[model samples]
Target: MNYEEARAYLDSRVSYEKRGMPESTELRLDRMVTLLEAIGSPHADFPIIHVAGTKGKGTTSTMIASMLTGTGRKVALHTSPHFERVEERAVISGEPIPGDRFTRLVEEIASVVEEIDAKLAPDQPGLTFFEITIALAMLYFSREQVDAAVVEVGMGGRLDSTNVVIPVVSVITSISFDHTNRLGNTLAAIAREKAGIIKTGRPVVSGVVKEEPASVIREVCRHLHAPLREAGPDFVDQYHSKGLAGGRVEVSTWRRSWPPLDVALPGRHQGANIALAAATCDTLEELGWTLPTEQLKQGLRLCRVPGRIETIRRHPLVITDVAHNEASASALVAAIPSRPEIPPSSPSPPRVLIFGSSVDKDWRAMLAILLPHFSHAILARYVAHGRAVEPSTMVEDASRAGIPVLTAETPARAWEEALRLAGTTEEPQEPASSDLDVAPLPDEPMICITGSFFLVAEMRTMMPLAEASVRPISS
Candidate 1:
């Protein structure tokens, strides 16, 4: 099958990321196991670094893979919820699987997938889009003889398809409230779900600092006899400074201290992620992996995750981040360049926001956190996804928060409106009663497009040629 045909085959399956997740009772791992067994269990061919958390899992996974690659070992990195292409979910040595190779891989596995589908029991669910993708990634990595693979759990760890592998070192980043309906709402409950990746006698590196969740992870580690390396007590990261460009951080562990490292991803929260990646590397070293300190620093400095306060344009700086939850939204807000000081005579440059979110997310709470930082917001729905929350549904919330709002049918239209407003030189005005009041447009305004991955992906496709050519920094 060709590339388009392969994409169609995968898209035809049940996808929780595209459609909303079903009840937690319906989640099962038997199908994933059966599918892997039929395909020779490729996940067992290499050492794996399994990562799971509510936030920063992708960044942590990328950092670990880059560090492994910097040591001259072939590494495979698999992440989910692709921004532009499905191939982004699978990478070998810093490059996405080529289109022809992806097509061939899918074709090779197509018969087995069909056979598995044909034998499902009445109560059993079919293979999902996520499961297929994880299988394909493992198969590709095994075929290439990768030294290691860093796999990010698609969601909560216990039932996630990526959890099948017993990793060399399991890394759990900051735990926060996300997918609360599927995972439990309390911190301890969520921590238990995320801690499911901790295997017997394996070491774990965690960034959870809160006692409620940290205690859960600790208890699990104790019961399983897994070595636990907590963030605050085992290792620490210090945030030196931040700017629109990026941030500077220094990480220290019991093994050694590294010089201050420059990170391409911004946000004070990234300090914790960097520390988690460093500590995971340390644990890998303890497991007899050869990773020089300088090479580790090179990986930390070069690794970058797209859509994490990523600046796509310069003049009137335009940023896009996939911040769907309150914790991530708070981080995105904190990372935005603080309003510049202006003379008493000049008005502060307006901060324009283009926002959208999924139906299951707490969009109102997100808007409450984000709207205050901007002069006004342009709301739109992500056209490609069916789970987008209606833009009109958020108008009352924005009005209640005393922020002007404008609605658009699609993300492209929202960008157009933001550019039109940004180009205008108008004085700030008092809040008006109408819902569509976009009155205050200032000269040389900065824009932030955020709220959902789908929205950010759509906005990214509309970027000018110059901005679109800027690649993410990694190995």
Candidate 2:
């Protein structure tokens, strides 16, 4: 198929998300393994590092990939919930694969779609956007003959589409409640799902997880005879700092030096993520893989994971984040710079927000976590894609949080309103022809773009070429 036709066909694959795994993907590993076998065993082409967790998986995956690249290894990476294209899910040597190569790879993958489908028979759920993306990464990595590949679990580690591979070392960053309807309800149950990545006899690295959940993971490690090294228990973060742009942490384990580590992504959560990445690096050391300390530090400092507390423009300093869950929203709030320090001469501008979310999230709880951070909040729905909750209902939910809010037809217009309020010179001052026309104010107020990952995904499409590098904080 041609490129546009291939893109359209890929878009059709999104419908498979509705076929939610009724049981944990971990329990169905046998089936996932069989599926891999039918595909010519793509997982065996190179060494892979499998990572899982709720919050830090994406960040940790990037850190690990960045570190591997430091050693001059050509690496292929696969992570999910793409803020842009399915192609963004696959990266080689810290850069996304080019579109022309991506389309050609997809065409090759599509050619095998019929064969893989027939192999599954009744067990087939059809290839999902994520599954197809993983297949692409495997195919691309094999074609490129990279030294190693770092793969993040698409969801819960065990049954996640990426779980079919046998990784060199497994890393579980941390576990928390997020995909409750799909993963599980409680923290322990969720940890159980993430623990699915642990392979027998493989050494695992972990970070600070809640007690109950850690206990669940501990039980699994014990059962699997998996050697596990935990961040706080086996290693600890010696120093932590927060700054206007972001912060750094110095980690000290038995083997690692007290090195200052920078994470371009905002949040205290990232300190934990860096420590997890450091610990994974230590695990790689045990496997005899060498990493350059200077390059590793550079990766964390310069690494850009879009939309995760990413700044869009200056003057008013517009920021965007894809913090959708309660824990993450709380982190986003803390990560927002104190209004006072942002502008030394200019008077502080009250926080204004353009927020949206999907139906998968707890509307009330997510709003409660973020509402207080803003003086004015505009509630909108991410209607362009699946799982969007209505904007009107979000406005109602924001009201329950006792915050002043307005509903918008779409996140795009909501963003326009936010900039108009900021009065940024780079933006159009007047509202477009629509049911709403927010008065354009001075471009001094700090505005944030947040809510669903899909919302952030759409926002990136509207970005200028220079703004394309910024994306939601992802693994």
Which lDDT tens digits does candidate 2 get at residues 1-475? 6778878877887443433345543244554455456567777989999989887688778878876676677877888777666677778886777788888978877767767666665854666666677777787788788899999887787677787887888898877788898788999888988998888998888784578888888889899999988877787774354443556787876686747987655577777887878887887878887777886776566566777776655445567788878778888888776545445666547577888887777767878888877777887766565567778776656886665677777767877777666655365222222201122134347777787777877876775522323432222
Would you estimate the TM-scores of all the predictions?
Answer: 0.94, 0.89
Where is model 2 more than 4 Å wrong at Cα? 14-35, 119-124, 238-244, 339-348, 423-443, 465-475
Error of 2 at 27 (Å): 9.1
Worst 10 residues of 1 by lDDT: 430-439
The candidate that wins on TM-score is 1
lDDT of each: 0.84, 0.72
Candidate 1 local lDDT, residue 100: 94
Quality of model 2 by C-alpha lDDT: 0.72
RMSD of each: 5.7, 5.5
